[model samples]
Target: MIPLTLGEVARVTGGQVHPGSPGTEDLRVTGPVVTDSREAGPGALYVARRGEVADGHDFVDAAARRGALAALTNRVVEGLPCVVVPEDPDRLSARPDRPPYDAVTRAFAALGREVVDRCAAAGGLRVVGITGSSGKTSTKDLLAQVLPALGPTLAPEASYNSEVGVPLTVCRLTEDTAYLVAEMGASGAGHIAHLTAIAPPQVAVVLNVGSAHLGEFGSRAAIMEAKSELVQGLVPDGLAVLNGDDEALVETMGGRARDVGARVVLVGLGERADLRATEVVTDERGRATFTLTAPGLGAPEPGLRVALQLVGVHHVGNALAVAAVAHEWGMPWEQIAASLAAATPRSRWRMEVTEREDGVTVVNDAYNANPESMRAALQSLAAMRRAEGRTLAVVGGMLELGADSDAEHAGVGALAARLGVDHLLTVGEVARPAATAYQQGGGARVSSVADRHEARALLEEELRAGDVVLLKSSRDSGLRVLGDELAGVTD
Candidate 1:
């Protein structure tokens, strides 16, 4: 928010407003600001939204102490106005026949409409909403890094892609931001629609769709429907970029691209895409070399080549997505090339390598795990080529799949078996599921650790020279600590 009057807040959210100061124009927003509260300034109207175990409303008093002028919560605090919705937030089964779940979904849709209307009035922020089955974050990372060359812009700081995260990112959009790259993920249909309402993108991209939330959405078609929500909000004259490589993306998004009044552009290794990459090459170091092509566009389609701060082949697709977007914005091929080459990764966990006292190398990619990212990270390790020793993979259970977790885990485990990782360290309750798959698939030296503590203790004693170890898990699993511990670790 550039700055809104108290009346503006009421007008946007349709909420009752109590005047904070008699003549105040400073609008307040309340949300979590504890270890990270410094990010929010004074006059923030915090939303004490509930979490898994504890109610954020309980911290309302403490949050108020830290400069929240007002708090939005489900339950009424002694001195705050409560914005209550139906009790069930997760009621809306994509199944749709779930009764009041439909009603709840309608309420969220209405809320999303209000959010979109509110953000649209903020003015002049050109938003770029991004969604994918995978690589949304990496593509966002590349977009944020490149856009600065065009003008000052802010992509959401972290996993700011959900309902709560999208709103906060919008709140941070000052008049200074020329572009806002919004990442949208969907567990069900209408999620992308809700996300798009808040940050109605003039330009948007769909990286690709995958079955990330299948446990909730039930099928890949449902997942595609959910992710396609970003394009639904695009202006008719805007551009909708799709991954031509993904068949479902092409099928669902193609006609919807027409429906939104946006022009469809495609990007992929495929020869058909309007913005495509070809002739890509990578060395043992995971440094890529490639020429990009936009065949139908004529005029010898720019011969672009570059190295990236991000290590892994998957990033080529991420870079190509960013390049296509930059091209749409009239950026020169040279600047795009320069930005891609100059972009140093901000990720602390993804493909980070550190050395131990015994000269062992650890590749820390533990910020998150999915089948696609797991395969990419493993391939990066494989290409690293530990000359004297071996590649050790430490994998943990990916969270939030809801069900079918065993099969997905097993798939990654089997891939590890095929990739020839010498030692496998599995963490968490799902360790047995993956380790069994790996061992069954002929992966030797498998060790299913009791926990990170056990894995750390076990790893300290056995790691040898020239070894490349990768640690990965879902964010909830607290795997980054392993990466930090290994950086200067001693046995």
Candidate 2:
């Protein structure tokens, strides 16, 4: 964050100054803005949020001890200079925990907005917002790596694509930051709109809208409406990148871009796409090699061949999206392909493949799941060659599918069965529909375990030296630990 005095923060957040001393309002915050007191440091402003089990107010002294500049809270502490705002429940209730939490978030968002606006006014900050039902994180990782080749860039650590995460990414913008790659996500309508207001994008990339959050959003149309908010929020003459392969997205998002008078770039496998890929071939490990052609970037070179080390053919689309952004910035095709070919997955747990000493391969995609990603991961697992070994899917529940949860799980089960998976292990009861579907599809070996321990035991007894296993579930499912332990990523 750019240097802001306690007085400026209070004014921006519509709060009052509750200084520990007489003249501390002039104290400038020049470092990061953090929510947890433990993350506070010199020149940091600690946002004291009230969680379910703990209150952040209790740690004000701890933050002060760590050289924090001030605290943004509703109540005053003895040792810390505070910016006190009124406690309002309705504004702060977007999350699971309940009142002053939302107030703190609202204030924190305002501070972030101020910082972003200041950076934009001073020049050299280009915010690129990426949103999709799936592949947001993967595309973000690609863009993060590609952008830094041009200039200094800041992207979220993992799938930090929520309201709070967006603000945190925005606040990380220093004066020297030239690019901001923000991954925006939404459960319902208007979430991305709010995120865009915090740090508006000059370049907005809308990936495909799939069944990732079908339950929260009742229908595909509604999900499209929510994801379109990114392109709608673009500044005048801003660029809107849409996926040409997804028929729904191509039609809906193309119309949205035209409606807003924003410059549009369609990127995918489509023949008429602005930046298109052709002759896409996936290797034995499910890595892709594709020929990219863009007439917009004038070069006599017919095409650039990009060989990706990342697993899965789905990443071909992600690479094209990143390539479109780089091309818009005038990066040559050879350079874009080079940077992309050299890029690896920076975010953990999504197609993170580790080959154990025993020659077993563990693909940990347990970060999050939906029907689309589940199918993709399963396909990638099946694509890997095993001479005398088999493929196993250690699957679990996919949450927030609403009424379609069972059917989606069943569809994934059918897909696994059709892909010729040797064994199907469902971790929890929520995944029973998938197990049942697998059996219905004439799958030979199918087992349903009550917990991760039971699932691990089953795998230990059944897995062989040359077999390939996939651990895929939502974040709360805790299947990632088993993958980490088995793959030697953790003890």
Identify the candidate with maximal TM-score: 2
Residue range 1-491, candidate 1, lDDT tens digits: 44544455444544444434454324544343221223434666555555557566677666556666554444456554333333444653344422323322233334444544545565555678899867777788889999988877878777778766676666665546677788887666666776776678887898877656667777777777777777878976888888888876887888887897888888888866887777777775565666766656441546766777677777888888788788877788778878998886775677777776687888888887776777888788877766688888899878766677888889888988999988888998874677988999999779987688898999989888888888988777767787778775333
lDDT of 2 by residue, 5-105 (tens): 99999999998888646678888898778877788899999988777798888999999888898899987777888898887756655652222236777
Q: Stretches of candidate 2 above 4 Å error?
A: 88-101, 296-301
Question: Which portions of model 1 show Cα errors greater than 4 Å?
Answer: 19-40, 73-123, 297-302, 488-491
Q: What is the TM-score of each candidate against the true structure?
A: 0.87, 0.95
- Pairs in clash, predicted candidate 2: 92-102
How much is 400 displaced in model 2, in angstroms? 0.6
What's the true lDDT of residue 295 in model 1? Answer: 50
C-alpha RMSD of candidate 1 = 4.0
Cα error, candidate 2, residue 238 (Å): 1.0
